[model samples]
Target: MAKIRITQVKSGIDRPERQKLTLKALGLNKMHATKEVEATPQILGMVRKVEHLVTVVEVK
Candidate 1:
């Protein structure tokens, strides 16, 4: 599977609980935190949920 880098660009503060939890699920706890993960559908779905709070970069 391909890989992608997810970075928490914005804070989850004042956001909904679900979004905050989604950030945590993606292993993001602080701003600018980055996690490299497989580009699986389930993980993609989670990213879609918090797209506003993060930035996704495809890893070559």
Candidate 2:
């Protein structure tokens, strides 16, 4: 599987609980925090849910 990097670029404060939880599921707990994970369908779905709150980059 390919790998990708997810970085929490914005604060989760004031966001919906579902989005916040999605961020947590993506291993993002704070602003600017990053996690490298497999680019699986599930992970990609979760990223879509919080796309506005994070930045994603494909890992070479």
- Model 1, 18-56: lDDT tens digits are 999999999999999999999999999999999999999
Q: Candidate 2: misplaced stretches above 4 Å?
A: none
Q: Largest TM-score belongs to which candidate?
A: 1
Candidate 2, 1-60: lDDT as tens digits: 999999999999999999999999899999999999999999999999999999999999
- Spell out the clash pairs found in candidate 2: none
Residue 33 shift from truth in candidate 2, angstroms: 0.2
